[model samples]
Target chain A: MQKVIQFLILRINFIIFLFFEILALILYFSNNPYQGAAFFNSSNAISASMMDFSSNTRHYIELQDVNDKLAKENAKLRFLLSSKIVQNDISNRIKNDTSTIKKFNYIPAKVINNSTDKYKNFITINKGSADSIAVGMGVVCFDGIVGKVKSCSKNYATITSVLHQDMLISSKLKRIGAIGALRWDGNNAQMAKLFYIPRHLEVKKGDTIVSSEHNSVFPEGEMVGRVTSINIKGDENFYTINVRLSTDFNKLSYVYVIKNKFKIEQDSLESLNNLGKNESK
Target chain B: MKANDIVKTALSFMIFVIFHVLIVKYFVIGSVGLCFFYLGFLLTLSLSIPIPLLLLISFLVGFFVDLFYDTPGIHTFASVAIMFLRPKIITLLTPLGGYDEIDEITISSMGVRWFITYTLILLVFHTLIVFLMEASGFSYFHWTLSKVFCTTIFTTFMICSFQYLLFTPKS
Candidate 1:
């Protein structure tokens, strides 16, 4: 008993150090990728406020560029509204139709902090659960698709940007209608690779890639990126196509979170089908 | 003597942390490397302080920095590890006269060569742990290594300048 006590006393520092190191490792491993249990992320109160305060100072500096982008979006929205009104009149005459419900809502949020330099980058936005933001919601800017909300606190949310290594978006080429999954290779923030696309499909540089209907997070046809290059590894089943992301993550300031109204219904139906399959088996 | 040491250490600790988070954190070199002059806090901690106290202080400082940096517990892990290893490092690099007889740990108290060597060793060790944790894995092995090397050089230079220009050796 005395020997054990002496042994412990002799190596007490090492024991204490091991205890703290283990605790820290637990925190790191637990609060990653999923981030569901992460309370110390940037979206948390202290970090979010610090970033918010700094971003507020920077906001005034980029006012001119922000204004230009807003005006351009405003012009495009106005044109779309006018064209929609004409279509409504024509559709009303053609067939008196009703029953299609609104499927998506956009919640405006300002990005408080963002980084494009890391392998797994995240963007912290000023809106969180208080503003109806939730995990898994798609976030988009005026230009194109941004990313999905990974986690949320009371008044802030973290977005796992498309540049992140783990993020994969279902995408389709507009010109040739080829479908693939978009993933970042951890090299460049501006570029992503589209995988699982067959070489037989007619593809070209500058082909527009958009979010596919297959993805539950994003609405179909929302711009994802443009194909920059196609690399066909000898006799491989899939062509690796490089894409230039539409949304510039480094300069991102404002974004809109997509709230899909039909998500609940679609998810329930899918789960019910799974249940039925399980029962049959 | 104890009261005076306490006051001096506290003041320096606050300055190191503030300097790190507010100023140095913003200065990202080439968008990859960052200067961690705040590590001066750990490097300059008085040798008379106990191992347990040092561990606690390092954890607190690391936690505070993590709160600002949004890196969760990576800093805490690195800081605590370095604190735990500090005694062993000192023992290994002990001068013929020994560290037990030394008072303050400023560069002036310890000769410039010893100070430089000591600071560089601990700084590199801490930075390596931090970069590895931040990268999350060895997947970005090359990138993480470059980041570690760049930050080590940058931080070593900064710490040397800080010690030479700002730090006043206790008379």
Candidate 2:
């Protein structure tokens, strides 16, 4: 007993070091693509407040650019509203029962903190559970789809940016309607890779990619990016294509969090199908 | 350590944490190089600090920085591993006559060559661990290596400049 006690005391430093390393590793692995606990991330109260202060100060320098973009979008929207074709179509459309039902709600929020240099990037926004911003809701800006909300506190939420390594966006060619998955390769902030695009499909540079109906989070036909390059290997079955993301992650300011009213119903119906398959098996 | 020294250490700790989380976090150069100037605090800690205490301090500082960066355990693991290797590296690099009166690791206290060697060795290990863990695998091996190399150089330059500009040599 005495020898064992002496041995343990002699190596206390090593033991403590091991203990902390193990604890830290657990925290690392558990919080990998997304963190389950909100307190450990920037969305927590104190860090979020600090980010809010910094963002408030930095917000003014980019005001001119933000105003320009907003003006352009406003002009486009106004043009659509004033067009005779759109007005005539709207007036002649028959009233359908399903058309009256609201499917999605948008909540405007300001981004307080954002990064694009890391392998996994997250955006912190000012809206959270208090504002009806929940995990898995889609976020979009004026240009294109941004990302999905990953975690939320009472007053703040963290979004998993499209630039994140683990994020896979279900997208399709806007012209040809060929579906593929878009993912960031952890190298460039402005570019991502599209996979599962069959070689037989005709993909060309400048082809637009948009969110497909297959994605549960994002609304259909939301702009994702434009194809920049395509690589076809003799041995590979799928074409390796590169896309230039439409949303400028570096200068993100304002975004809208989308709440799909039918998501719960759709998810439950899908899960029921899976349950039936399992029972038959 | 004296009471005065303890107070100084605490003050510097807060300054390092705040500066790192706020300013240094956004100073990424070309998406390749990142400056982790906060590690300067760990690298210059008084050599007499026990290994256990050093480990604890590094873990806390790393965890705090991680919270702001939203990289939970990545920083903590890297800093802790480097701190554990710190004492051993110091013993291996001990001078011929030994570190007779030197209490802390600084360029003024130790000569430039010794300071560079000590910090370079530790920074390489620190950055290697950080980038590898952040990458999560060998898949991005080449990209990760480039990031590690660039970040170590950037961080070293920042740390050296800060030491020269801030700390005065003892008479």
Candidate 3:
């Protein structure tokens, strides 16, 4: 009886260890779906507050770089403003006969926490549902696109960065307008893979790539990256294009979250169209 | 454990967790190596602590770090695995006199060579598990391996040196 009791006790230890390990594995895998509200992620109030404090301490050193970026962005915006003034007269005449309306709003947010080292890289921002930030909203920086809002708590939100393994953005060649999809290969944080361009299309290293407006997430012609290299697979009809992402995620701080005013109407209309097609069938 | 030892352990635990989340977490080497200095908290625990208790301690520690790292269960999984394997490793590397005389785990208590070997084995195991899980699979096998190697060497050096420089065996 004594021997049996000791044996059972030993088995119990292994059982408990296994139980905890299995629980950890379940949490790890469930994070992949991008919908589960994870309790332990950095966007939680406590974690965000901790990171906010840390970043605040280092904010002075980072301030110079941030200022430089803001100045450059200011210059670019100034140039755009000057150019727009000249074109405004012509645009006004054209606009009087046209019905084009703005459909996107931008909410600026500060990055409280970010990591570029992991395969599933994420960024935590200071905006959340309280600021009208919602999951699936697009995030962009001054340079170009950054990521999409993944999850949000009361006052913080996490971004699924462009560097993540499963993050795919629809993009197009700037010069030729050939459409393709961009995805990270999980190797280099600076580079990503652009796929689905046909083999016959003229693509070259250094060709610029930009976001396609077909997707509701981003404005058309927003710079995504530039082609760094192109590989042709013999069996496939598409060329595997390598792109150098424009936004440096390592230095990312300030970003804008895109709110599509027409998203609800667009989604409802698309679903209605689908329903109508199904009923017609 | 005596009151003094318990107090010291609590003090060190707070220092480790605070240092990890506040300072070391930001120090990444080339987007590959991550500094998990809080692991020393678990590594330095008294060998006499029960296996179940140690596992629970590691889970909570890892979970706390995960909250700050935005990694959810990655660190927790790695920490628990290393804790579960800690006893087997200690037994395998037990010196000629055995673990009878050992109460606490530190470089001064275990000798330099023995401490290095022990720390290397466990740190490497922990780093491998963490990098692999972070990559989500063998998809980035070479990248993950390099990260494991980089982090193990960095963390082992840091932990062993910190232990050697500061830790003193308590009677």
Candidate 4:
């Protein structure tokens, strides 16, 4: 008994070190900040307040850029509104019924913290569950798609930025409707790769990429990026195409959280269809 | 450690943490190189600090850093690892006779060559663990290697410069 006690006492340092090492590893492995609790992340009250203060300080320095972008976006929105009005007038005349259900609600939120340099970058916004912002909701800036809401607290939420390695945006070439998956290559912050587009399809540089209707997270036809380069290997069936992202993640200030009204219903219906197929098989 | 030494260490701990979270966090040299100046606090601690206490302090400091970076355990894991290996490294790099009267590991106290070697070994390990865990795989092997190399150099330069500029040897 005495020998055992002495042995344990002598190796206590190693034992303690092992304990903390294990604890830290557990936290690391379990840290899926996107799906897990928001306590340890920037969405927590204390960190969010610090981020808010820092962002407020930075806001003034970026005022000119923000104003310019907002003005340009305003002109685009005005054009869109004019065309939408014309379509609405024609539809109204064809159908006397006035009921038109709203599909998406945009909740405006200010970005409090953002990073574009890391392998997996995330953005923190100043609105959360309190503002009806929930996980999996699509976030978009005026220029292009931002990301999806990963987790939320009462007053802050973190977004898995488009630069993240694991983030895959379902996108299609606007010119020819060639569908592909857009993902960051973990190197460039402004460029992403479009995969699964077959080599036979006609593709060219400067073609626009937009979000596809296949994903409920983002609305169809949302601008994603423009193709900068394309490579077609002799052996591979798919072309390796590079896209220049439209939204400058470094300058992200304000974004809108999109709430899809029929998301839950659509998901359930598709899941039920899959279940039936499985049972039959 | 003396009471005064403890107070100074604690004060420096706060300064390093705050500086790292606020200023150094944004000071990235290119996309690949990131300087983690918070490790400067652990690196310069009095050589006599016991392993258990050193480990605990590192864990706490790392946790504080992780809270702000939104990366929960990555920093804590790397910090505790370096602190745990610090004593072994000191013993390995001990002079022929011994450390003698040396109290802390700083460029002024340990000389430039010894300090560089010590800092390089520990910083490389620290950067390796951080980047590897961050990438979570060997998929980005080349990029991760470049990042590790650049970040180690960047962090070593930052820590060494801070030590040389700010730390005044005891009279």
Candidate 5:
């Protein structure tokens, strides 16, 4: 013990350094990607405002198109509301529907920051703490499901864009109920991969895919993209499907933050079930 | 001690964070990418700072990069490792009969080969630290191979190109 103490004192800094490093490694493997992003979370408002101002120039055109799209959607929504029976039927169908398990509420906002050339992709939005934007919310632009909520600040929050390498989405085919996980290969912005789908199911080109309702990030049936190619890698038991994204992420201006009230309940229940199964074994 | 150094450190830290965030969150080339992007934090720091401040600055630099990149302690761990090993890397590249402590160093003064060699060695160390941190002990061999090959090559290119573009060449 005396010799060990002397040796430790000789390299106290080194020991402390190694100690801190090991702590960091433990945190790294713990699956909390939000660990170190807490620093420099605040950026100068001047740079942010300047960025927002520059975005407004390109946003004017999107506004006009957005107005047209909103008008069309409004007209449809109004028509449905005007018919009480139709409204009742839609609500009843939603209540009775058992295929999809995910639920969501969307809060609309404008994109403040966007980048595409990097490995991890994130988008900053104008709405944040004040707008009740929290970490873990899902962000979806007109194109499709963009990504999950990463971090939140007073006036802003970052969303993990689907174009990111860390992007993982629960998705399924619209025509067939086959479900899988969605990920990007960091090669092309136009393409992503849908893996873990069993090969027994019949999948084809141009098949529409959407959120699988597996998690509370996005509502089920939200558009993802269409399958462009499929490869079965020599009895791997899963079909690798290449997907072309629907949302033109490069030209994104506005998005909606999806909130799920049932997320907590659902996650806890799932975890409990998993734990129960593990204990049983 | 100078105001310029302080401001430079703060500004550079932010840029490094943004660069790291973009790559990890957006460009994520996977295991290969995690290594390259994480190096941006350290490479940016080592470029302009005084040498004696290495261990202190490198520790904080690693910590800061780890924070922004969401890699937990990977940045902190790797950076400190490099800080300790930086002296050795410099020693290896020191021409025969020449000896200079790390404190007396900058990019322009060092010839191109020496500079590149210096940064490459640091980058290689940085990559090893990061790749190991990311790899969940699931499949060690494949992860180790991919991490080393992909990061060594990719980080070399990125570090070289970025340093070339950002720094002013001396006459």
Candidate 6:
């Protein structure tokens, strides 16, 4: 009887092991990461409290990296609000003399977790649905573009990092004005490639890339990256320019969502124009 | 069966989870982080967490670690595989100096060499799961080789160092 009980206990333990492991596998393949996200969120409150207690009790050298990231973001904010530099204006040369400032609302949130080393990477932010952060909004850390929101529940949203292949940002060279889709080829974390640039447009190494006005997602002239090199060949149809992202992607912490006040109105006009073009066809 | 054992296990698990949250998730240094995150494996192997409980905690720890990193299922697979292999590790590393089954795992009891060997086995086992899952398959031979080499070196050094820190000297 004793031997049978011990065997039954061992088998039960194995069954439990299989159950938890299988649960994890099922989560991996499932379309719903939000389920796991929810579990983490609930546990975070408890874990964070525990860490607050324990981390203080332990010796940690990792604090330096977080400090460095914070310092860079602080420097970036100072530059953004600095009024010393003259605005670069090709158009409205006379109107540029009007010193009146335009006010734009900004939302700030810290990135609790993010990833850039995979074929697909996501970012978990401290802000949530209640914070007015919604789907399709753009996230920017430092002066560079981060990524767009993919999913949002009540208290959190999963942002697809710019490192992911699924991400798309309309970007252009600051000097040449040549526009293309800025994306990653699933290789390096610090590098991305600009595609669809016409050969006629002059692109050179060390040129700056910026978000275009046409992209309602971002304000025009926001710095995206610098053109590290351009691959131009006789056979290729597009000039693929390699970009070195200005913001250190690995150390991202704080970010602000680029919410355009005119997005709703601009989107309606664009849809209307597309509908008319379709009707004529 | 002692109450102290249960408390120790719970405390260790909580520490590993917190380590995942504030440190490993936010800060990364070229996959060197697979080291600190392996604290879960170290915690499991260092003590005699019953095999069933070991697998359960390992799976949760792995899954949670992967979740924070935006990885799907890689952490869970790696952790559970190591958790399953830990009993064999304990037996392999059982002290020739002492015949008694040591309930508590500490450097004072196991010594540095045994600890290193023990950690190396768990790290290799844990790292293999991570490499295989991340590499996906053997289709890209070069990638598989790199991932294997990278994970092995990284986990071995990391797990051993963590063990050294956790075990306080009795003197």
TM per candidate comes to 0.55, 0.54, 0.54, 0.55, 0.51, 0.48
Query: What is the alpha-carbon lDDT for the whole of candidate 1?
Result: 0.86
Where does model 2 exceed 4 Å of error? Answer: A1-43, A83-93, A96-101, A279-281, B1-171
Residue-level lDDT tens digits of model 6 in A1-281: 99998897878866776777787677665624564555566687565445444543331445676678678878876886563344443344555533223322457876666677789998877667888887878888665888888877666667888889987889988897877899988999889999999988778889999888777777777789998888988988899889998767787766888666667778899999999999999
Q: Considering DockQ, where higher is better, how would the candidates rank from best to worst?
A: 1, 4, 2, 3, 5, 6
Each model's fraction of native contacts: 0.63, 0.63, 0.46, 0.68, 0.51, 0.46
Query: Residue-wise lDDT of candidate 5 within B105-142, one digit each (tens)?
Result: 43555666776777777877777767755563334867
Give the Å error, residue A199, model 3: 1.8
| Share of native C-alpha contacts between chains A and B (below 8 angstroms) recovered by candidate 3 | 0.46
Tens-digit per-residue lDDT, B89-157, candidate 3:
988997787765767887777778988888889888898888777766577899998888888888887
TM-score for candidate 1, residues paired by index: 0.55
Candidate 6 residues B58-135, lDDT tens each? 777776677676777777766777677677667776666644667666556767677667766677666666665555
Task: Give the DockQ of candidate 3.
Answer: 0.21
Off by over 4 Å in 3: A1-43, A96-101, A274-281, B1-171
DockQ of each: 0.29, 0.27, 0.21, 0.28, 0.20, 0.19
Overlapping backbone residue pairs in candidate 3 total 0
Worst 10 residues of 3 chain A by lDDT: A34-43
* Model 5 per-residue lDDT at B18: 63
DockQ of 5: 0.20
Indicate the docking level reached by candidate 2: acceptable
Better of 4 and 6 by lDDT: 4
Model 5: lDDT of residue B90: 67
Global lDDT of each model? 0.86, 0.88, 0.85, 0.89, 0.73, 0.70
TM-score of B-chain for each predicted structure, in order: 0.92, 0.94, 0.93, 0.95, 0.73, 0.78
Instruction: Please list all clashing residue pairs in model 6, or write none if there are none.
Output: none
The full ranking of all candidates by lDDT, starting with the best, is 4, 2, 1, 3, 5, 6
